[model samples]
Target chain A: MVKLNEHDGSIISVQDVNFYYGASKALTDINMSFKKNQVTALIGPSGCGKSTLLRLLNRMNDLIDGTRVEGRVYFEGKNIYDPHVDPVDIRRKIGMVFQKPNPFPKSIFNNIIYGPTLSGAGSRSDLSALVEKSLKQSVLWDEVKDILNQSAMRLSGGQQQRLCIARALAMNPDILLMDEPTSALDPISTAKIEELIDELKKDYTIIIVTHNMQQAARVSDETGFFYLGKLIEYNQTAKIFTKPDLKQTEDYITGRFG
Target chain B: MEGTRHTSSQYEMELQDIKDNLIYLGVLTEKAIASAMDALLQRDTNQARKVIAADSEIDRLDMELEERCIRVLALRQPAAKDLRFITTAIKVNGHLERIGDMAVNIAEKAIILNAEPQLKPYIDLPRMAEIVRNMIRESLDSFVNEDLETAEKVALEEDEVDKLNEQIFRELLTFMLEDTRTITRATIIMQISKNLERVADHAKGVADMVIYLVTGKSVRHQY
Candidate 1:
């Protein structure tokens, strides 16, 4: 229910939201807000519904069977949960990157241009320009510029992950939802992704779900600590990690309990 | 659950090691201050020598703790609370080391005062050392438990030590003015008191760092 100003469009807002899996509730009375040009990290232990919460933002949860969501999700001041809202259109504006690097079987150029083409962006030159812009935004343009025609699957796991990020950027989404995007990456790759996230925050609103507390502390402006399907604490990332007001948050961050 | 619990246990063990070493340094300095005071009060040269000998261990542990803090900073790249902890560890290590040196200063003054007959009973100097020791212990506990309020309280107590330092200097001045024979002993005791005052100042510095570590606000210049 928290609201930010609309200077840069306020990005996404969740109000009194609830989710259920058949007869069991997965999220309860959740209310949160994310602003444009900032990174908000969702942190909690496994099975804490942090990933579920991320999916709910972009309506990716709609594909899951027996999953029921209630309440409103607003993006750009429009209610995304309205009956007439198209999930495809909503997803086009809000892109997502998964945990594992799942690059397509096509070339690196094709991987970057695939989403824009599917969305019917423009002609070949337009797609090429968009591809270059996206890759450059993700800081991967120079490394793979010579091999644009090569298969993306041949790239290393870290490179593929950055390629996936570039693919998400092609659509020029207003918000990006990343679910443990660097969990499978090595330390060097993790550092690169973290740096990319930092740079991206100046242009796009980012919501990241990370189990690594250090990553949350490093890359996030705000952090929400979720526990047992509830948002236990939400505050500035520095406060959450240094001196959390809640004992549960303190215990979790200090490694006293999880 | 087992894996998570194991990781937490290891983290706790590392934290406990830091806590124990800090307390060990605290106790050693506290004892050195007490014995240094005793040497000045009762003209006990042997106790002053013991205080001097004990300072070497305090110096050794200060280096060890500082190196550990640097290693943690390089290896863990800790953030937030952990980052504050390592940073505070470095500052507190310096404070404790300075406190040890002040104790050595007191012991040197005590040796000189003991050789001369005696200063007059030495009341305020012992009182200053006692307060400094408590400040040392409380500051370390504040850091070990991350208690911001306790750290703030210790910071406030520094004022009393400062006042006592002034009072001791005034009282010794009167004695030096009254008798020429009392001048040498009174001056030496005044130096011992001044060293105790500096130890209290260093202990307050540790307390200030603890407050910063807990609240992430610098209170170095503030009262």
Candidate 2:
């Protein structure tokens, strides 16, 4: 077992981790660390376990049947997979945003406040404050401040995605895990979200899994390249984009092969 | 390796086109340098004028290559070594184009020197020009082959050109001191030697970019 330490700037550390979906393995012997207040991007071809690794961070895979995670994932020096630890508590500290904008059928106000409301977090005024602060953090406050009562489904895809981000931010997570957050977004919206990500990194540790190489290059401080269930290379985003240490990483990023 | 074909054949072709055009540009600049030096040694004003006229094509290709690199950046959004290659291509393109300008500068000075009586026998100047020409060739060859050894060879030749340039200047200085009439023609020859040295420096610049493209490290001012 690797000794886990939290003083090293890393907020989460994965050591000797292997994951399986029933009998088939999905990730193998993965080891890496995510630093505080920095955006780390996980990039690889589709089904290369990049997204699977992102999901493993907060134990989101526990919701899937017949899936097992071996080894330890330390979050702030605590093993999240320990039976004594609560997965719900781990999740609240590490929020997530999905690929598509899956806002609820409720009003936009409800969508932002829903997570806190279910947790009985605070009073009505506190919930309203949380809604405003989360929306502002996601950079969607001005767009939807007047339309709080409108159904979230009525918002555009990009707005809905930002609203989902706001929904996650409402939980006040220390780390935000995004699995291809802007894959479905248009260029303009994507740029806005990317700008928001740059802004949000000052306050939150972000781990993003993206298939868009340029987006990974643009938004990430550190980038990890995964191939066939193994980490091929991990380095500064500039180094990874300009001159990766591994030929397989270079080949994939250059669009030579998947 | 760069030899692997891109999944998008069109993108692969676009990158290949830049390489081809650079090689073509390299050939033109090499010819201009050789011709300019030939004109100087043979005292042929007409050949010098032809070298001057040939620079417009090099300038045109420089603009064309820059636009293509920008297009690839905006469209294909290349990454890793391809990104390095394209960005390096932009820089190497500038160096090659400037090499062309240096050749034209030499040719312009050659025309002036050809009008007057012959200066001292052109021994060191021709040798310097030959080495500079080879520097440009080897630098471009390193870029095309991604060969570090060839790029290092070009860097080593830069010092050789510098030594020859100094040798020519010191020898010419004695002539100007002994007889002031030789000052105008000797100074023009000195300018031609300086231009050749500058061309060698530009070739070294191309070699530096090739090193960056191959190894992802900048060796510009380090040595």
Candidate 3:
């Protein structure tokens, strides 16, 4: 197997991760690692297994009946799919954000505090401080501080997406899995989330799955181009954007034969 | 790679337009250098004036090629090889335009030298001019064909032009030293040789950009 990334100190290592939806193979022998505190973007067309690969990182695929994943997904150092390992615990550590803003029908404050509350978090004042810190980290505090009690659904599409990210951060996760986190937002909103991702990578390892090639280039430290359930090429984002070594990767990004 | 056609023919044609304008600019600059050499060798002031007048076309093409490159960068958002090619096109466009200016500089000196007596047969200078013109032609051809061998060949041939330039300078210095009356013509001939040397340098620059476009390895400042 040719490895594009050689990060020795990987936070999450996916080795021969083959996933299947009943008889159909969704991912074929994916071998990659998300390094500590670095943003890795998975880019490809629809049904290319980028999102499936992201879901495999946090074991979100376990919930889907008749779906199976064969191989190891080591988070920190332990294989996440090990019999002794708990998927719920894995989910708590490797938080995920979806394509559309799926904030609960609760208030903005509730959205940030919901994940912490589920895991027997802190006292009333402690939760409030946690909410404030998470909102500030996600860069949504100033816009929504005065309206913390407002329904999260009332916020704009961009703000809702940022709220979703804030909700994920509130879990104090070591890694963040974003599957098309900015696809539903407008350009301005997408730019804000992209900037937030840049800042967030200082402390958290980010593995984003985006269909937007330009956004992947703009935000990720490394980019992996997947085609037909296989990682065609992966390299530094600058190399991927300006001079990809593989012709398939170049053709896809430049829209020659995507 | 050349056989692989872009899905969007308009974008492909826009890229091809940059290449076409670049080659056209190369042709005009090559013509300018040849005309300047012809004007100097035959002592034709009218031919030198024609070389000077024709440089505006290269200048205009330079602007057009740069604008086209910018459009592809802005609108098409070219990636990988296309990105490399457009950047190479813009840099090569500048080199060719500067080469055109150097030809005009040579033409100006040719007009002045034609006013006076011949500068003792003009052996190495015309040879230098011909070598510089071939360098420009080959450098552009290497870029158009994505031919690394021709690009490397252009870089290798530059040393000969430099050697000729030095020989011409040393021979003319002896002419100036022997006869004080010949100093004016000697210096003009020396200036023409210097301009031809500069044209060779610009051709080498184009060759370096082509090498980078093909191999993504910069060979500039290495030679």
Candidate 4:
């Protein structure tokens, strides 16, 4: 219920939000605000509503049957849950990367240009430039540049994840949501994805749901510890790991309990 | 509670082992200081030689304990309170080693003073050595228990040792001025007092690290 400092306009705000599936509630009253150009990490055990919360940010939860959401979610100073607002338009400003690297069964060039083409970006020259720019931004251009016309499924798992990121970037969204984006990759690929996230935070507001506490500590500016669908603590990453004010947070970060 | 309990119980056992070794070192240093003072006051050359010979074990243990601390820091990568404990152990281990060296200095001075006739009864010097010994013991205890209040109390007692040093310096100055014959013995007694003062200063340094370990704030120069 605490109002954070009104600095450079908050990119996303969740005010007293709660989500439910039929008669069962998945998230308690959750109040959080993420600043522009900053990365926030959500950490908790399995079934802790971290992914559900990320989906709520972009209204992806609306696709689930019997799901009900309460309270306001403000993006760019406008309430996204307003009755007049279209869910499709809300999705265009916020893009998502899932836990698995799910590239479509199409050419690599087609995958990166899919979103922009669907959004009605004009001209063949503009589309090609957008594809190149998105691929470069995701750090996948060099490896896939020569094989632009090859099937995306033919690329490696790590390359496919980066291609998924490029696809998201082609939409030209201001915010990015990654739900355990590197959980399936090897250590080297995880490192690459981590490096990409670090670089992407400079130009895009990022919210990541990660189970790895060390990753959260290394990459996030702010961290939220969730338990039983409720946020137990939220603070700076250094404070959360070293000298947290709440005992629950200290116990969790020190590996006391899940 | 489960995970912290596991790590802390392990830390507690290791800390206890370190405390036993440190206390063993403290007792050896205390005996050395006492015997060195006895040789000075009673003119016993045999006791002075024993004090000089006993310093080898203290030096050996100092190396052993320091090696253990380095190994733990490299292996465990301890954080927060555990990090503070390991760092304070290193500082305190150094302090105790220096105290052992100071005792050897006193023993060497006692041997020279024993060769000459007694100038005066060693009243304030033995008292200062006793205070220094107690400070070393209490500082180690403060570190073992993470007791901030006891650490602060030990820090405050440093002024008493400083005052005793000044008192010994003035008394020796008067003795040296009164007669040329008493100059050598008086200067040696002044050196012994200075060594004891340094021991107290090292003890205070250990206490300061304990305060930092418990509160996560440096109190080295704040008095």
Candidate 5:
């Protein structure tokens, strides 16, 4: 329900962002800002730079060899791309959930505490409370309350996705980057994850990349329409889906083009 | 923006069919208004009865178009311009169906007036009917083409129809005062003119919806 002009509370801003995979450019002069306590969905075709733009938020592109980025990505008041800024520290503050439900081979309780334990977050009693709170926030606690010691891989596909979300939640990040987080799950899980995304936005800024247009319309406060490595249009979700001014945005939303 | 077709040819064709049928329904209602007026002018009870019988077809088209809009909302999940057009179509469809009923109302009064001796010669009454009938046609034309200019023209003509309706009422009041026998027929003539005036209002409603369809901003009460 936030207006387009009310984004002065932006938590992260990407200014003049460009990405290249060795010789070929992937994203071209992209500019966007992620407001606090809101979900921004990036939607387009498979190679539209939507996913590439998402990974740039927390410097996930740093792991790739031939990928190079040229832009200033500001998180809070500081630029995360500064040479002194640690990518690992930046990633810890900006957690991510992948397309597949990639829980560790450990037990459910261990999966939830993997990140916090490495950071030496708390004592035994504190870790127990954090696990319960994170699982509850992800809406997976009731289903797995009695079986916290069970292996995460043994859970259903939907349950595993929720577990991955809980693992990210345990880190207590300011933002959560999700890359097609529900693409591998069935309809029931997708709905539950969507509900959680709505709830999660109350505390964290969420940036999601997805192929499903309806999901983008349903969960996002703002949406960016990407095409061929260009950010064609970015606006509030209601305006983008109801009365887009641009012809390309209308054509894409109305199923006029592939 | 013209002839910018959808990527999915089937979806584009389906949307076009819905729009075409909406205009077709508009045409049918315009014919109803003209026939009902003709029946009154010629004092032909058979023509009035035919207009009454054709009301069922208008009702049928209204239902079919509603179902098509609901189907598009559910299946196509349309967005942007298509979304505005579908919503506008539903509102305009309601206005046209109500206009058809108003025509029937006029026909029922026409049937009663035909049973009695003719009152004073109907001069402004037929003129009012012609203006209202043209309003219906123009409103539908604006909706089909998403023409803002035609929609604005239709909105402006509604004021003229209202003035004519008032003039007809003042002229009929003299007939009721002069003779008691003429009072009955004069009242019915007044009701027929009132129905024609209402038809103009419904046409204006269709025009307002067309403006909304073309430019997502509403112009309902501003005019």
Candidate 6:
């Protein structure tokens, strides 16, 4: 059993972590730390294990049979992978938004309250207040406040994604994990989400995986470059985009990579 | 390690074009300074006039290079080293153009001095021009090869040119005090020396930008 040491300024720390899918190894001895209230972007070409690493943060990989994670992933001084710890409780504290908007078939109001309601958040008045607060935090309050009862499927792709973000925020998690949250949306919508990311970071630590390099540069405070399941470089976003220390990082960001 | 081409060949070509044009501009300014000094030494007004006439070409190339840099910045949206390279190229282009203008300043002064009787056999001014020309060449070479040593050498050469400028100034001051008749020609020669010194400063400026491009750290105004 790993000791439950007190965490430093970082909210999450991954130490000597290796992940495997069946017999195929995915991530290798990865080490990183995420600070509180910062937007950290993970970027690279596809199949770099950036998405795998994001899912691993909240124990999202535990749902898949034969997928195994080795080493310690400490959240708030506790190793989340310990057998005694609950995976459901770890996930509740680290909510995720997917690449595509996946609102439930139900109305927007119910979508926000689904997780809290399952945990037995009773009373009609309490659920309604939670819905309004989450929607406003995701910057969707003005557009959808009047149409709270409407089906989520009617919203645009960008709105639907923000609605998903609101749904994630409904749990009042300390950390938000986003996997390519803006890739499916149009430019204007992408801009809005990027702006929301800038605003949300004041209250939440955001870790985003993005294929779009400009979006990573625009939205992230720090950036980590991943390649072939290995972490290449992690640095301040300005440093990563302007003058990375490693040649491999420079090659990838400058579009000179093989 | 030395030459990794951009995956976008067009981007590779765009960067190459900026580099080639900068060297061409460097060569033009070098020739202008050489011809203008030769015209003064040999008292040849025609060569001075030719140097003066070549100024328009330098101006045109400077504008063209700036436009290309801006286009690359907007269209390609380059990052990391490519971003540093483009920004450096823009600055180097401006320095080279200013060097060309200084060459023109030297040519105009040469025409004035050539009209008068020989100014003290034109010894130090020609040496200064030669050193300034070499500074321009080495600075641009440093940029093309991304060679830090060559850039540092250019900066040291700039110091040498400055020393030569001061020596020439003191020597000409004595000539002016000895005879009132030599004042006009000696003043023009002094103006030419000052212009050559400024040209060396501009070359040093190019070398400084090259340093920033290669290291991605600004060394400007620090020395």
Best-performing candidate as measured by lDDT: 2
lDDT of 5 at A226: 94
- Fraction of native contacts (fnat) of each candidate: 0.32, 0.95, 0.68, 0.14, 0.84, 0.86
Candidate 6 lDDT (Cα, 0 to 1): 0.90
Interface RMSD for all numbered candidates: 4.0, 1.2, 1.6, 3.6, 1.6, 0.7
The DockQ-derived docking category for candidate 5 is: medium
Superior by DockQ: candidate 3 or candidate 4:
3
Provide the lowest-lDDT 10-residue window in model 6 chain A: A1-10
Q: What are the TM-scores, per candidate, against the unseen true structure?
A: 0.89, 0.96, 0.97, 0.83, 0.96, 0.96
Candidate 3 - CAPRI tier? medium
Q: Candidate 1: RMSD over Cα atoms?
A: 3.6
Which prediction has more favorable lDDT, 2 or 6? 2
Model 6: share of true interface contacts reproduced: 0.86
Best by TM-score: 3
Off by over 4 Å in 2: A1-4
2 or 4, greater by DockQ: 2
lDDT (Cα, tens digit) per residue for candidate 3, span B1-223: 2646788999989888788888888888998999989988999999999999998888888888888899888998888888888889889989999999998998999899989878699888878888888999999889889899999999888999999999999999999999999999899888888899999999999999999888777889999
Candidate 2 vs candidate 4: the TM-score winner is: 2
TM-score of predicted chain B versus true chain B for each candidate: 0.90, 0.97, 0.97, 0.89, 0.96, 0.96
- Flag clash pairs in model 4: none
Give the TM-score of candidate 4 (chain A): 0.96
Q: How high is the lDDT of residue A229 in model 5?
A: 99
Tens-digit lDDT string for candidate 6 (B65-127) = 999999999999989998988888899889989988987888898788778778677777778
Off by over 4 Å in 5: A1-8
Question: Per-residue lDDT of B1-223 in model 2, one digit per residue for the tens?
Answer: 3667899989999999998998899999999999989998998999999999999999999999999999999998888888888989999999999999998998899888888888778888888988998899899889888999999889889999999999999999999999999999989888988999999999999999999998989999866
Considering summed lDDT, which 10 consecutive residues are worst modelled in model 3 chain A?
A: A1-10
On the 0 to 100 scale, the lDDT of residue B166 in model 5 is 95
RMSD of each: 3.6, 2.3, 2.7, 4.2, 2.5, 2.3
lDDT of each: 0.84, 0.91, 0.89, 0.83, 0.90, 0.90
lDDT of 2 by residue, A176-232 (tens): 999999999999999999999999998898999998888999999999999889998
Off by over 4 Å in 1: A1-9, B1-7, B71-90, B117-121, B137-153, B174-187, B208-220
For candidate 1, give the lDDT of residue B220.
Answer: 94
Stretches of candidate 6 above 4 Å error? A1-8
